[model samples]
Target: MSPARSDRTRRPVDLRQRSTMAGEASAAEAEVEMALDAPPDPQAAAFFDVDNTVIQGASIFHFARGLHRRKFFTTRDLASAAWKQLLFRVVGSEDPEHVAEARASALAFIKGHTVAEVEALGEEIFDEAMAARVWPGTKALAQLHLDQGQRVWLVTAAPVELASIIARRLGLTGALGTVAEHEDGVYTGRLVGEMLHGPAKAEAVLALATRESLDLSRCTAYSDSINDLPMLSLVGEAVAINPDARLRAHARDAGWRIRDYRTGRKAAWAGVRLGAAAGAVAGAAAVGAALRRKR
Candidate 1:
């Protein structure tokens, strides 16, 4: 096997063994009780979808502003993007066509931009603004996995650079996102493959599982929209956080856990007979990485 592939497969096995050992030695019985319905698997993972699942809105909206300041796009372009952001907030993005169009628009906009330049801008914007908008409950859950020694990864359609920033700041393992094609340190205005949405998200998680030796039946996934159904369905534990209409219906019928924090009310979980609530986690810093499409 190639050295790169060999390392990818070997590293996760090592980490999993270490995690399993750590979890077994942990004395946090209370936390374990909360997730008793689906017992913890140290070798598995807790995958979270970004955007509405973890943060208030699309990370791309803020990234657009940053790019505008740097003259990547103009005032008129920013206004249009802002309008779309408002609509996304009210009406969740579940439509495949809508997602595709957004992806195309973002790819077109960033064409020819140097990867390093865009990544640097993304870091600045995220540190300045995006950190405050993360949902406390979701952040807590991600942290719980970390405390238990399970892998935690942010799965989104945002650029890998932006996703990596959010994941690192949140103290999670890493991220999987859309890959933009670049050559000689410059973007080629094309994608490496499909945008990481819908089935693409599911494929990425499965690939990670293969490399990590993660048990899909023991893994958990959280999302807020229907577009992530394939991913949510792949895991033993599926959580719907601030779910849109479609996902809420599906979660209800499937008896999956649901948490709603959009109404200024305390977030409550539904359909699970758990001993305790997932413990509260301290707020972490958030940041806008860039204007990229998310499903």
Candidate 2:
């Protein structure tokens, strides 16, 4: 037989042997996967995207808004929301760039504050932003994770300390957020961890799954933004809650659950009304001074 003919015959047999081994491995894995996926305990995990998911808008933007109400923030604070709202409005939708700009500018506002002050302000913002707009269904879904003894993690690109404070106030189980480098009491404006959004979010979820011994095949995730698609798809169940349009379309295509939490109710306006009342009193004082000056 020719040398080339012999080589071809040997290659076919080797290929068959490799294919057989691979088929066996795949079959074993299929068995294990079937077992792991077997009616995963009515227990389920729920991941929340922090910004627009749990709160009315971006959390840090709301922080800036509250600061604006306090009338002490720089123009950069308003600039945070300006470009975003304008872009989203003009296009009749949101783009990832606008969302990211809002996040970056909002976190930039953290560069100068002492940790204690940030914590205090974070608490205050939680009272205002979350009090009036926290979706009840979202919290209830969180409770469901707790009842199932599954993990309830707040996933966001905000600073970890800020996210944790918000979680504790909301009675959540855990938090996974952007980690801005910090010294004793002030931010260094550098990130300690990867930005916890988009593909980074999915990586965080996987890391948590491995650390916590979770089965991703039995996990669930919730978010409102299309940016969360990476993490949402990592789970067996992806729930699109109060979702934006892009996410809604993706969820529909994937046959995921899409829920609406917007009751069109912005009730229980907490620190907000307090801020407003304070403003009204100040306005009255300024008007009285103007009248006296005219007289």
The candidate maximizing TM-score is 1
TM-score of 1: 0.70
Per-residue lDDT over 98-156 for candidate 1, one digit per residue giving the tens place of the 0 to 100 score: 44344455465456558787678778878876798788988999998877768788887
lDDT, candidate 2, 1-295, per-residue tens: 9998887667545433432332222212111111233333533566787755676655655554565566554455255345444343233223444433433433443454456766776788778765777677888888887666565778775555567777777777667765555688776654443345465667667666665567888888998778678789889899988776678889899899888776542453334323322221121112112222222
The TM-score values for the models, in the order shown, are 0.70, 0.65
Kindly give the stretch of ten consecutive residues in candidate 2 with the minimal lDDT sum: 26-35
Steric clash pairs (candidate 1): 126-287, 126-288, 130-286, 131-286
Q: lDDT of all predictions, in order shown?
A: 0.62, 0.57
